[model samples]
Target: MSVKENCQKIEERILKACQRSGRKREEVVLLAASKTQPVEKILQAYYCGIRYFGENRVQEGIEKIEALKDYKDIHWHLIGGLQTNKVKYAVKYFEMIHSIDREELVDEIEKRASKMNKIQEGLIEVNFGEESKYGVKEENLKKLFEYILTKEHIKILGLMAIPPYFENPEDVRPFFRKLRQLKEDLEKDFNVKLPHLSMGMSHDFEVAIEEGATIVRIGTALFGERI
Candidate 1:
């Protein structure tokens, strides 16, 4: 599908999901996951009014950032695994690091940010279900959050989760719902402001939005399957 067509279809899904959940369509944010996609496709997305772009690798995202940083005000999100050694490039280029859950890595990011004199915007990746790709385990999230908050060079904006994907998108609702509730519980019980829920993907974003996902990472739905 063309960029315009993908954008239209995604918008329809967002709107339909919002309506289904009794929320406004404008409230949900669509982040086009552009891993392996070229700058030209991103330009196409920009033409279709996509402002947020997500990349899954630091090296690949840096390439895209260099190619199109001047072309648009695109917010680059690091949606893949982030290592401590690569914190320098990540801190310099990414607007948000979406997979941050380990305390040791968080320390490294803070140290690197301190050296660079920058406070990086980052999210706490949580293992919301049986799928354990790259997030901190559920029980350790609170302690990790408390420890990271003490660091001046790193700010915890919200949470990110990759709920286990089922062949049927409807089966994905429970995970999204759990993530939303987890954020709410963390805020109320822990007395912290976590307004963002960075969950959902191409196949099940509508379910994510219905469960209150502010940022949806979608790639295949926008740019087709990755090579």
Candidate 2:
């Protein structure tokens, strides 16, 4: 199917998921994970009414952002594991970073954003103690939040996670539930409101939305498999 057709189908699914979950369609943001896809494909999604796009790499995202600079309403997101060296470019280009899991990263972002004279928005990536995944452990999340609360240039909007894959999407529900619960706990503990839960992807986005995902990062289901 074409990108437009894929977008239509995904939109329908998002609407139905919202209905099933008794949530408003406007509440969920459909972020096109335009990692390796070319600008043409992103434009196709843009024409289909998608305004949010996520890139996994800082350099690639910078190129795409430059190429698509004329599209003023587009919101770019960095959704991969960000390195300290790349913090400057990532802060300058992307509107939000979705993989903040350490103090070093927070410090770098705060410094860069402060130099650029802008507040950088980000999400705290929570790893379920998976050695392979990149995120702060659940036990260490409070500590991370405490440190981030002292920073001036970067703001934590919510949480993001790449949960363990399950053939059946139902099995992933618990992980999503855990992320949401963590967000709730953080809000109460810090007396702050973290509004965005950047979880779920092509395979289990509907499940993510049902569990209070304000931002769903979808790629293959929208842009087809990467080449």
Candidate 3:
């Protein structure tokens, strides 16, 4: 199927999942994970009513963002590892960063964003799967949240996670539930409202939606397999 048809199918699934979970379709943002996808494909998805696009690398995203600069109302999100050196470009191009896993990275982003005079919106990526993964552990989340609040240039939107891949999408539900619960606990503990839960991907987004995913990062399902 074409990108538009894939997007339509994904939207239909998202809507059905939302209805099943007693949530509105608008509550979840379907971010087309455009990493490695061509600008033409991204444009196709955009024309099909997808306004949010996510990229996994700084330089690639920069190219796409620069090329698509004329497309108004497009929200770009960085959904991969953000290097300290590349912080400057990532801050300038992407509206949201979803893989903030450490305090040092946050510091770099804050410094760059401060210089750019931009308030960088971000999500705290948590590793609910394995210890070797690239995400903040659940235990250290509070400390990270406190530290981020002390900075002036960044705001934590919510939590994101790439759970262990499973053949059955149903198996990924726990990680989604855990991320949602973590969001809830953090909000109550810090008295802060985290409005975005950037979980889910092409393989398991429907389950992620049922578990309170405010933003689902869909790639292969939207743009076909990455090239």
Candidate 4:
């Protein structure tokens, strides 16, 4: 399928999923996960009405920005494991960082955003159970939420997670459920209004939305298999 056709397919899927889940079509935001994808693919999606794109690496996203700067109004989001040392480049490129789960990374982002005179929004990534991942464990959310409240430059927008992918996406339900529960628990305990849940990807986005995902990072489904 052509790039425009690819984007349309994804949009149709989103619209159907929203209707199934009893959500408004506009409620869920589709983020193009253009990690290794070329600028042409991104531009095609943009032309087709996709305004947000996500990258898993700072360097790759910066390269995309340099190549596609002419396409203004695109919202870039960082949805990968963020290194503290690479915070500045990330701050300069991504409007939102969705995988921030540590204080060091948050501190670096805050420092960079302050120096750059910008308020960078961030999502706290929670691992829920998979110990082999990069997100903050579910148990530490309260403390993290409290600390995020004190940060000035980086606004705590919501939570993001990458549950261990199972062959059948249904196996990942427990993980997504935990994330949704954590969001509710955190909001009940603290007065934080975490409105966004950046969960789901190419494989299990439908499940993610039914579980309350506001942002779905889709790549392969929209751009074909990555090389």
Per TM-score, the best of the predicted structures is: 2
Among residues 3 or more apart in sequence or in different chains, the pairs in candidate 3 whose N, CA or C atoms overlap within 3 Å are none
Tens-place lDDT digits, model 4, residues 128-188: 6777889888888778778878889988888999988898988987788888888888888
lDDT of 2 by residue, 146-177 (tens): 99999999889999999999999999999999
lDDT of 3: 0.93
**Local distance difference test, per candidate?**
0.87, 0.96, 0.93, 0.88
TM-scores for the candidates: 0.95, 0.99, 0.98, 0.96
**C-alpha lDDT (0 to 100) for residue 47 of candidate 1:** 91
Residue-by-residue lDDT tens digits, candidate 1, 103-198: 888988888888989989989998854554889887888888888878899888789999786999889888888777777878887798887899
lDDT of 3 by residue, 53-166 (tens): 999999999999999999989999999987899999999889999999898999999999999999999999998759767899898988999999999999998998999999
Which stretches of model 1 miss by more than 4 angstroms? Answer: 129-132
Pairs that clash in candidate 1: none
Predicted structure 1: clash tally? 0
Ranking by TM-score: 2, 3, 4, 1
lDDT, residue 124, candidate 4: 93
TM-score head-to-head 3 vs 4, winner: 3
Off by over 4 Å in 2: none
For candidate 3, the 10 contiguous residues with the lowest summed lDDT are 127-136
